[model samples]
Target: MLPRLIDEHWRRIGFTQRPKLAAIKHLCREVDLLHPQVDDNGRRPDNVEYPWTGASGSAEVPAHWKFPLMSRLHDPSGKLLLKAAVGLTRNPAMFIR
Candidate 1:
């Protein structure tokens, strides 16, 4: 379910390449600019788990999950990301229904 959503969103936005772990880290930093409160403890509501934890050990886990959502939202193109996020929060039943 989640992978599909990600693939579709990326495709729609013309992101021809999937992000590497390093790129993801960069995106997280960018998103953090918009949401300083979101950390990378893997405790955020929808946090992305650090994929290279085995290679980097526990030190690589993010403090928050905002990167996944924020990576999309922080794009300078438009506010669709924000709108989608707001929609999810405003209508919980949308997914549950």
Candidate 2:
């Protein structure tokens, strides 16, 4: 269910594209945007054990389950992104249909 949510919202707005993805990546590096990413301890909502000790970890997350949600300058959940996408290109006449 949640996986579909990301596709519908984020990717739908062109986040999956090379340009947008690169732009977001660059924006994050240029700014000091640090979002919550499941502290190094890998604390899960269910209190599960973290699998990594940061020995040979790559820059990007291994997987979604390995990371936590956070709000950074490059956060894909900014208010502007939500509002702009909301009701975008809606047909007013459809309300009557």
Best by lDDT: 1
TM-score of each: 0.26, 0.21
lDDT for residue 55 in candidate 2, whole number 0-100: 43
The TM-score that candidate 2 achieves is: 0.21
Residue 87 miss distance in model 2 (angstroms): 2.4
Model 2 error, position 81 (Å): 1.5
lDDT of each: 0.44, 0.36
Residues 1-97 of candidate 2 have per-residue lDDT tens digits of: 2223333555545664422444343433322222244342443221124333344454333353432223433355333333333434353221222
User: Highest TM-score, which number?
Assistant: 1
Q: Relative to the unseen true structure, what is the C-alpha lDDT of residue 53 in candidate 1, on a scale of 0 to 100?
A: 41
Worst window of 10 by summed lDDT in candidate 1: 45-54
